[model samples]
Target chain A: MTTVHTAASAVSAVSAASAAEEKVDTCASEAAHPPPVARGGYTISEVVSHTGLSAHTLRWYERIGLMPNVSRSHTGQRRYSEADLGWLSLVGKLRLTGMPVADMVRYAELVREGEHTFAERQHLLTRHRENVRQHIAELQDTLAVLDFKIEHYADARRASERV
Target chain B: MTTVHTAASAVSAVSAASAAEEKVDTCASEAAHPPPVARGGYTISEVVSHTGLSAHTLRWYERIGLMPNVSRSHTGQRRYSEADLGWLSLVGKLRLTGMPVADMVRYAELVREGEHTFAERQHLLTRHRENVRQHIAELQDTLAVLDFKIEHYADARRASERV
Candidate 1:
């Protein structure tokens, strides 16, 4: 009976692993186009082209301690692997949302600790989401103001033309 | 005929000024209620209390040249006037919207040049608005990811608890 139970558990473990593998595959395809940084390492220029970020800004981000130390080729040039690109894509998303460099550094610290700090990472992200939500609401407010101003100016132009 | 036209324009100007003066009177009422600081001058402590910002942070911001030179009283203490507070409020709003200190300084330069730079100021603000709009869109994208992650974790939590 113990042997049979062990066999059943072994079957469950295999099935779980297979399901997780499938999820990973699906995620790989669904994440982005161009297959996510391709296979091997890419040069800094290649990375810049693929990522749509300027090389100087990328360097500045690295120098400001915003990005982790990238891997280097034997010739001392930066070589970004697939994982590094994925990480950068996430960082880009965060930055595009106007997350401060200091806050991102703190998040990066949590990420470097691995899965043990998942709760903290989640909390930080949630807080940032709240901030973003408030910002979006404010933007909507300002967009309304802009639309009003634009219309008012257009009316003034129309009146001036008539004169 | 010219006198009549000039008289009509003068009357219109007086009405406009009266409307503006009434609005200011309304603002002064709110500004003075339980007044945040004394009428003549405010110490650094008063500024900190009213702004809900730390003294160290305030000094750091000023030291980093983010703030203008604050006026000093005869006792060598910072003396903040109502104009200073008003300017600080605008700065706070810009900072909350993630405008960099450097960019704020650029905007301030245009402001200090007065109405001669009105077109430049408008251009800067228009560009900043576009940046903010893009930032908001990126945040919406991240918010979607966060919602997915939160739901995934919540489901996992329930599944584990069930076991």
Candidate 2:
């Protein structure tokens, strides 16, 4: 009975490995011919072109824990998956709003901690959105000031020309 | 004729000095009783409070030629005039729009060069205004993405709770 149980365990392990291998095969085919949305894997340069981020910034993001651990090729070069590209895209947007690097790292940690941190992640993003709103309002006020000053300059120029 | 010229020059000098003293008296009275709009001369600390800038930053502005040479008191302390405060206010607004310090210094120089630089200053401000507009549009787009992600998190939380 003990021998039969051991055989059954071996069979289950083999089945799991086979399933993983099948998934890898699908990934391999996708990697060979990348889609427009970047489903499979990409090189560092490919990611740079796709995301418009410099290679230095990308490496810095990885070092700062703003990015998840990227996969590696057999020769030990970095390989970025589609999921990585998606994360980078989000990071790029967050950066444009001048979100602090530390806050971005915290958000990344929440992402890696799984689905339970969703609520907390939402709260972080909501707070940042409010900040962005305030910044937009301030810029609008500055714009109004610029408009007034520009008109004043126009009048001054005309007056000088008349003189 | 030399004696007459000397007497006339001395009289003119005394008249100019007296006028300046009278202006200082008015400024001293205003400084003694600070107003809401902050006219007259202000001490370093007073300017700090009014502009919400640190004393260090104010000095740095002067050092970098971003500000004109502020008037000095008898004790060699900085004394900011109403015109200086007005210039600082405009600088504060420009800083908010992320204008570079070098560009601001250039603008300050143009102001000091008299009325001839009006067209150039106006051009610089107009270009900066365009940049601000683009920034605002990009931020609005990012805000939309944040809204979408926040909603997704909400739905995910609800789904998990049901499970």
Best lDDT among the predictions, by candidate number: 2
Among these predictions, the greatest DockQ belongs to: 2
TM-score of each: 0.56, 0.76
lDDT per prediction?
0.58, 0.70
Give one digit per residue, the lDDT tens place, for model 2 in B69-143. Answer: 798877888888766776777777667656778889999999999888999999998988887786687678778
Q: What is model 2's native contact fraction?
A: 0.68
**Poorly placed runs, candidate 2 (over 4 Å):** A1-40, B1-40, B158-163
Q: Against the hidden true structure, what lDDT does model 2 obtain?
A: 0.70
Q: Which ten-residue region of model 2 chain B has the weakest summed lDDT?
A: B1-10
Query: How much is the lDDT of residue B113 in candidate 2?
Result: 95
* Residue pairs that clash (backbone atoms under 3 angstroms), model 2: none
lDDT (10s digit) by residue, model 1, range B1-163: 0011112222233223333432222224544453434334667787676665557856776676666667777667777666666556555545544566777777777767765565666666666667657556656876775676556655665666698
